[model samples]
Target: MDSIPSGEGLIARMIEGDESAFTSIYRQYHPALYTYLLRICKIPSLAEDLVHDVFLKVWEIRHRINPALPFTGYLYRIARNHAFKTLKKLAYDEVLQEKVLEHLQFQGNGPEQMVNEKEYNRLFQEALGRLTPQRLHVFRLCRQEGKSYDEAAAILGISRNAVKKHMVLSMRAIHNYIYRQGLVITLLYLAQKIF
Candidate 1:
């Protein structure tokens, strides 16, 4: 079925115990939640299971949903909380924790992985080159030189909070630049493999 036009209407029907409306909600949000949970947990199978659990909770608490408010925010709140809780539980279970860590560790240490890592590092350097001079100085001081924020602030003649803000913005800019260039890197890798 196509997605319902009005979220409030769909949610109202869901609140009234309409299974179809609930199904519509599930179909609408499933992919986004899957991607989100997968990013947090880094395990596809576990992320799928967690998405199901999150929706189950949503169904159980359907009556509490305020249809007038934005549902995506509510859904993401539940997903974020559930993901963190599951990770915490995994951390406490030594056997399970070892298995998960082992799964992550051997995902790919091959030549292809090395090439991708190199590409990512190149992208990172490119991103760093785009930073403002002061931001670059702050980044080098705190990250490259391993200076404390207070020390960087004193050297730069800025407040500690200002140094902190520069670092945050610098990281954000670098991440966004790399993320935007990631598709090109992936396609180049694919082309190299095919050729």
Candidate 2:
């Protein structure tokens, strides 16, 4: 029910800033790209965001796109890179949150504590932004909302094992990111839990 455009012609029009050509390319590739990202990250929302980011990057670099080259491959490479970067950032933020939480434990629970709590909340949001939509939902339900794995699974309509898997992978990513950031002292605590 859909028609495919000539890649070379589409790229040429995109280079010249043709909105219609860009739209054509987007419509053609978006579904595949989103599916690919969702499979790798297991997050529907993140997949959509990655697709958006990939297309935006494509547009920004349209002038440089080689019409003679394989467009699909080039676009996929960009998507993969974007996904990796997003994952890394998410991991780093998770570790950073742990560090912040540890520091908060030492401070008196008062106005200063409230200010730190606010900062923690901000960082928590940033970390969540890095996760795929499904993963974010799972994390919030399980951790933030204080729901059990079974409860989250029922709420999300996923298996209990699926919920556990997401949590483990998410926590592992956070620990690995913290280790990579050279936070040795914090890593010690995280490693115990992650390992």
Candidate number of the best TM-score: 1
Q: Model-by-model lDDT, in order?
A: 0.79, 0.70
Q: Where does model 2 exceed 4 Å of error?
A: 1-5, 94-195
How many pairs of residues collide in model 1? 0
- Cα displacement (angstroms), candidate 2, residue 59, comes to 0.4
The TM-scores, one per candidate, come to 0.52, 0.48
Which stretches of model 1 miss by more than 4 angstroms?
1-5, 108-195
Residue-level lDDT tens digits of model 2 in 1-195: 645356798788888898888999999998999998876554466678889999999999998899989999999989877776665554457654453444434443222333345654554455567777888788889988999999999999999999999888776654444333333333333333321
Error of 2 at 190 (Å): 18
The worst-scoring run of ten residues by lDDT in candidate 1 lies at 186-195
Among residues 3 or more apart in sequence or in different chains, the pairs in candidate 2 whose N, CA or C atoms overlap within 3 Å are none
Candidate 2 weakest lDDT stretch, 10 residues: 186-195
